[model samples]
Target: MHLLRPLPQYLVSRYHGWVATSYAENSAWYRRLADDGQRPRAMVISCCDSRVHVTSIFGADSGEFFIHRNIANLVPPYAPDGLQHGTSAAVEYAVTALKVAHLIVVGHTSCGGVAGCHAMCSGQAPELEEKSSFVGRWMDILRPGYERVKDLPADQQVAALEREAVLVSIENLMGFPFVKAAVEGEQLSLHGLVHDIRAGTLEQAEDGGRRWTRV
Candidate 1:
């Protein structure tokens, strides 16, 4: 078998510099976090896209937010059928174990996952429809979200579906029994936000989805 190479030496050197500077400067805080463990007040589920910047946008420090990132930032319906569900496991841990006070689902514009779902559902990306296609199967969670925006013009559907993805995730998050109970008991709050990647703006779903006001 052919082995892959490690990160370039320049990247490794940069990491070492960061450790000697940033790590050394904040070593006390890092040590305290290790000793006390994490007690984050909110759990943020965002997209795997590198530009989402949940921490930078919120000015959050390490250990302040429990973050879980997945393609297109989706939450599948609650299913305890003994399948390997990574996203579900994260939600279970954050909600049941960590007892986070808030759960936020953040979707962003120009999401490749959302675009692929549009293509697959719209017959533009047939490869994703294959039974062995893991991405298509994982993106099935957003199929309903696609349906919500499929009626728009071809050029406009992707962005609309992006917003729907957030709505769908927020809806699916409630499907978990414990999450529902926690919300009803006033122990947890749910939020849906969409990031405008190019404009550097955020819009929030409000008035029970009647409108999305800029945040």
Candidate 2:
């Protein structure tokens, strides 16, 4: 908390400027949104990395997408424990309450989470048990993906691993009964997208022989 004081003031000032402009440009809509409720068409699961912003990437308005961000943008398989699960809860709310029509999992290149997973798998980083850190635990979700494509060339391996993680999250989405029902009923569509930050392009995972291609 002590480390964030300086930045918080700057951010608050910037946000005030944005708020002033937003009220001026869309005062009526803003008032209605504040009084009424949000009805987003899609829900996007994205990384919490400062560089990856779903709203900016999609050019969406405030209530366009119900967004959930986490380390590496992971979605664990549905579980009904007493523990609070942020990503799963968001998914539930988006699909059940908001009734969003689409759920998009966005994975970006050069993700620290992915790199950490790679490092752990390669024994470059300390073992999970030894570290006992949040990142280490969070990255456990991507272990299967890391193992699946560990044999490829360094560059290709990272891309494959990242894509694999995206697919895994999509599979995890299916673990939720509501998500499954929505998709099966043709009310919801699930998409896995990979964003090449350096290239400033998006790649949609495809079926058959073809793989990630620019969108």
Best-performing candidate as measured by lDDT: 1
Clashes of each: 0, 0
Residue 157, candidate 1: alpha-carbon lDDT: 93
Candidate lDDT (C-alpha), each: 0.93, 0.86
Question: How well does each candidate superpose onto the true structure, as a TM-score?
Answer: 0.95, 0.91
Per-residue lDDT for 99-215 in model 2, tens only?
Answer: 999999999999988888888887888865365687888888888888888888877887787787788898889999999999999999998998888888898878821477778
Runs in model 2 lying further than 4 Å from the true structure: 1-9, 208-210
Model 2 has an lDDT value of: 0.86
List runs of model 1 lying over 4 Å from the truth: 1-4
Q: In candidate 1, residue 168 scores what lDDT? A: 89
Whole-structure CA lDDT of model 1: 0.93
Q: Which pairs of residues have clashing backbones in candidate 1?
A: none
Error of 2 at 90 (Å): 0.6
Q: What is the lDDT of residue 137 in candidate 2?
A: 83
